[model samples]
Target: MSSLLVTGGAGFIGSNFVRHVLATTDHNVTVLDAITYAGNAASLDGLPEDRFRLVVGSVCDADLVNDLVADHDVTVHFAAESHNDNSLNDPSPFIQTNLVGTYELLQAVRRHDKRYHHISTDEVYSDLELDDPAKFTENTPYNPSSPYSSTKAGSDLLVRAWVRSFGVQATISNCSNNYGPYQHVEKFIPRQITGLIDGVRPKLYGAGENVRDWIHVDDHNSAVLRIIDDGVIGETYLIGADGEMNNKSVIELILELMDQPTDAYDHVNDRPGHDMRYAIDATRLRTELGWTPTYRDFRSGLAATIDWYRANEDWWRPMKAATEAKYAKTGQ
Candidate 1:
């Protein structure tokens, strides 16, 4: 059995991945997280104690990271300051966690000669024109728009450099937007889901024409596991499910699923420099790794997500008020 160190495992995607690994594999997992505002300790509840452990700490702590890396057979990095609006409000933490923290992990993995897998977002490719037929591919050039994306882009570059310059055993996967259970209410889909649960009208940014390619968190994690087992070193794969929808359509679907009027939503001030659309081409991952998403039906996946939030209100209720207040300040 492999010993895995998962940074930010208390966060949404990371937590899901932690559970996925435990349920599907024999790997013993240790989570190293700072338990930041975006992270929730409750998200990781009820796992087998013998195989799962959580470490409250920062990835930027080199000594701690090195110690963990030395013992783990592999490191899966999922920690970062990932919110665009939050990064716009304050870029300092983004730089510190995304750039410096990645550098520290790279150094530690290099020192230990351990296998590493870096999880990144497709936002690094910026956006395609709404009418453009192109989608972001593995070869897409980095053109990040927000401080969050920029810093993540920088972190991806650091991993590439480390792989080439030091031959650190590492691979990278840039995935499209992921939505499923345990997502923090601050994110787009969860915000709408939780808002509807609270009898609050969903809010949209601008005309809501912004497009995003969505994937289930479980599918993304499955692709990550695929890469770790069979993918070539220093290679980069793109993970997507071809689930593209505009902001307006997503909100309308949420309203419809929640038994509300389709038009019963509010328009709000748009975010600054909001990209028009984001789409991902996962041809490489599919053709090479033989991976496919289980939740190919967007509506069903979204409905399942809604049911999760409704049934598990206790998990997301704590952050709902603060998240809404933050958005209310900017009328978004």
Candidate 2:
């Protein structure tokens, strides 16, 4: 079995990707996560012990990364400061983790000559508006607005640098907004669902007009697998399910799914410089790698995800109650 190192495997997309790797392939997946608030061990609870291992560590630790890379066949970097609001409050940690952390991992992988993959978001592409939504392709310019995007953009640059200077075997996938189960409550979809379940009206930012291209976590996991298994090294791929929706639209959709009364949301101040719109063109990935999503449609996916949270109140209730406590502590 090919050994794979997945950073942040305890987080939303990373965790889903890890389980996908386990179910689909015999690959021995090693997860290195900091177990931060966003990273939950429950995400990997179903993983078979023999096929999986967890390392409580940071990608910023070069020595630890080097040791892990030396033992693994493939390394996928997914750890990062992902929340847009958190990045805006102060981007320092984002830079430390998104840029410096990625740099350390690159150094480690270069030393071991191992295959590497970087997981990135579509926010790396600047605002894409107008009638024909400009789908970000492999050649799109980096125009990150938020500190979170800036940090991710910086990390993507480092990936390119390592490929050019060190000849590192690496590939990067820039994807759209991911939604599904096991996601942190801070995220849009789950935050809304769980909040509604807790007898609270969820807050919506701005006019909620910001548009996003949505991809279910499962589809994103499959796309990453295709990239790692068959993707050409030193290349970057843009993977997105063609489902694009605006901020207000998705909130309305979620509220509808939950059978909540209309007008159940409170309007919050729009985030500073909130991206107006984002969409991706997956032509290259689909044409070259023959990679596509099994659940590109969000209707059933969102329904199932809501159902999961509804059925597993034991999984989300504590987090829902602790929400105010943590924010009060963080002063957010």
Candidate 3:
């Protein structure tokens, strides 16, 4: 099996991907993350050293990226600044990691023999008409609204160019919101769960009407393995959970799982330019890769997630405390 190097393997999705790779397969895995406040090193706590190694480094470091590329056969890029709330205030980190970091890393890959896989978000398709209802496809128009998504969209374009111009064997996966265990507490799902668990009323932004399709991290990881092993080169795959829900409904579901009433939340002003809805047509992924979500409904997956948070307070309390410090420093 070829060696796999996963960037940002300490963060939420990246860390879950690493865990999936280590637990399910015998392939050698290497994780390179800068260990930002959001990137907690403990995510990869107990994997065998023979099967996994974690390197603390930024993706922007060209030498480091090249060294890892030289060592690994496939590179999955997931190291972008992901929080929408933080991206609004200072978009520089997002620009640096998403745009500049991608440029540097792709340049390195162009000099080597490897496949580069980029994990991107659904926010790239922002200009969807309020009334015009069409799920975003791989060929969806690039109309990103916020800084975080704009940079992610930019990085995806750069990957396209590298494949077109540099002959890099590359593929991209644009996915919907993901909720699962060990996710940083800043995201909506984990934030709501952790806050409610802590006996605090969770805050909802702008009446919580924004619609999103959410996929479990494990299902997302399963689709990723399919993309790496079987997806066509120079193609983009949309991996969705076949689930659609609004923000308010998601909160209510979490409340239900936690056995709390629906009135447990406090509404707050919506962030500027918040997209009202986002949905993706993942039929191509299903058709081309023969991939479908194992958990077609949110009930069991979310119930398990809530149970994990409930059972693992030791794991989440420190994370919640660390996020509070980061938020304080950034005034988020």
Candidate 4:
């Protein structure tokens, strides 16, 4: 069986991807995570121990990354300082983790001549105007607005350069916003969902007009696997399920699904440098690689997500107080 090393495999999307890979394939997996506040080891519970292991370390640790890369047949990089608000608070960590950590991985994989895949966000393309009829494609130019997205954009460029300069076997996938089980409560969807569960009024940023193209975490991971199996080296793919909804609508849906009045939410100050809208065009991934998202209906997908947060309170409860307090300080 092929051995895959997953960086940030304990975090939200990374944990979900790790689970997806284990459930669907016979490959052996090693998770390298920093165990930061956003990374929860419990998310990885119940996996087959024989085929899975967790290594606690920073991806920026060159020695650790090199050793791990040398041993694994493939490296799927999902590690990064991904919270936009946290990046706004301090861009230093984002730079250190996203850019420098990616550099370390690229160098290691280059040395080992192993296959690699980079997980990125569609925010690297900045945002489209709310009224614009355009969606971000693989060809979209890098114009990231926030420190979080800027660092991811930088990381993506690093992979491309490594592929050209050193011929590293790496491909990148830029996915839209992901929501499902194991997501930290600090995120938008889970924040609202858990708040309603706690009888706290859900907070909406500004008038909540900012649009985000959502995708189920599983769908995103499935596409990632498809790319790792068949994608051309040095190529980039955009992943989306065409699940675009404004922040206002998303909050309303969460309230509705949670048996609360849709108008029971409160409006809050919007974060600085908030992108107006983000949409992804996944034509290349679908037509070229023959991959399509399973979660076609956003409403049903969101309802299921709400159900997850409700049923798995232990997974998200500890972080709820701290996360809400952080947002309250900034009134977001």
For model 4, the superposed segments whose C-alpha errors exceed 4 Å read: none
| Candidate 1 lDDT score at position 163 | 97
lDDT of 2 by residue, 1-332 (tens): 79999999999999999988888888999999999888888778877998899999999998898899899999999999999878877889898889989999999999989999999988988787746646889999998998999889999999999999999999999999998888888788998888888777777787888888888999999999999989999999999989888878788888888888767787877777888888989999999999888886788889989988888877666666676665445433
| Alpha-carbon local distance difference test for all models | 0.95, 0.88, 0.88, 0.94
Give the C-alpha lDDT of model 2.
Answer: 0.88
lDDT at position 201, candidate 4: 93
TM-score of 1: 0.99
Task: Look at candidate 3 and tell me the lDDT of residue 215.
Answer: 94
- List model 4 lDDT by residue over 120-221, tens digit each: 999999999999999998888999999999999999999999999999999999999999999999999998888888889988889999999999999999
lDDT of 3 by residue, 247-302 (tens): 89989988888889987787777788999888889999999899999888898999
Candidate maximizing lDDT: 1
Once model 3 is optimally superposed onto the true structure by TM-score, how far is the C-alpha of residue 155 displaced, in angstroms? 0.1
- Assess every candidate by TM-score: 0.99, 0.96, 0.96, 0.99
Candidate 2 wrong stretches, greater than 4 Å: 130-132, 325-332
Model 1 misplaced stretches (Cα beyond 4 Å): none
RMSD in order of candidates? 0.6, 1.8, 1.7, 0.7
